[model samples]
Target: MVYTKNKNKNLIGDKVKYARLKNKPKITQNDLLARLAVRGITLEKTAISKIESKTRPVTDKELVAIADALGVSILWLLGRE
Candidate 1:
């Protein structure tokens, strides 16, 4: 049995995008990339855009960095909390 977690249909990208953009001070993808850089994660703005558009899959490490950069919990990013 090969089980996949959050598989292809997960809304994590949308959630990350929302968390990055819908706050008190709306954060742009570039800003998010910069913040992630400070946290030792390197991601491009285009990648972030793809993530927001649901055209890319997010890895666990990337998800963690994104969650930390957005100041949201991983469970929240996964829509589990």
Candidate 2:
């Protein structure tokens, strides 16, 4: 299997990449973070960078925001099987 940097090593990079691509028509990482912050969730640019690069884990709550921001299901971001 191809190994990625995500701590889970279970398709996180691909998932994040997919999510990013899905939002391509309008949203962006920085915009997503701004929206999340507006919703009372505080996430830093580096944190998102790490998560996208598969160097960090996406928290449960953050997963929700990510899904929403990307217009996908939380299950998708978590790579649910």
Candidate 3:
């Protein structure tokens, strides 16, 4: 199944956008960094930004943080639900 933005409805992208929209931060990228930092993920703001835009890739652990910050299940991030 295709679960990517443009190509399809990417669960990861959706979850990230949902989480950022929930907080309404100053900048989307900044918000991603804040979320990751709170979870002790320690990634650059650009990295998260790239992930959101689908310009870069995320590791399994990073995906977990993305899921946690978004308050979504990991299975959801994996597009299981």
Off by over 4 Å in 2: 1-11, 24-26
Whichever of 1 and 2 has more lDDT, that candidate is 1
Give the residue spans of candidate 3 off by over 4 A: 1-11, 22-27
Candidate 3: Cα lDDT at 35: 76
lDDT of 2 by residue, 1-81 (tens): 776553442335567666676664856678778878876779877876677777777667777776776778776766674
Cα lDDT tens digits for candidate 3, 1-81:
765546432337655666667664433667667877998898865776667666666778888887787667888766687
Q: All candidates' TM-scores?
A: 0.81, 0.70, 0.66
Q: Flag clash pairs in model 3.
A: none
Decoy 1 TM-score against native? 0.81
lDDT of 3 at 80: 80
**RMSD of every prediction:** 3.2, 4.0, 4.1
Best by TM-score: 1
**Which window of 10 residues has the lowest lDDT sum in candidate 2?**
4-13
- Clashing residue pairs found in predicted model 1: none
Highest lDDT scorer: 1
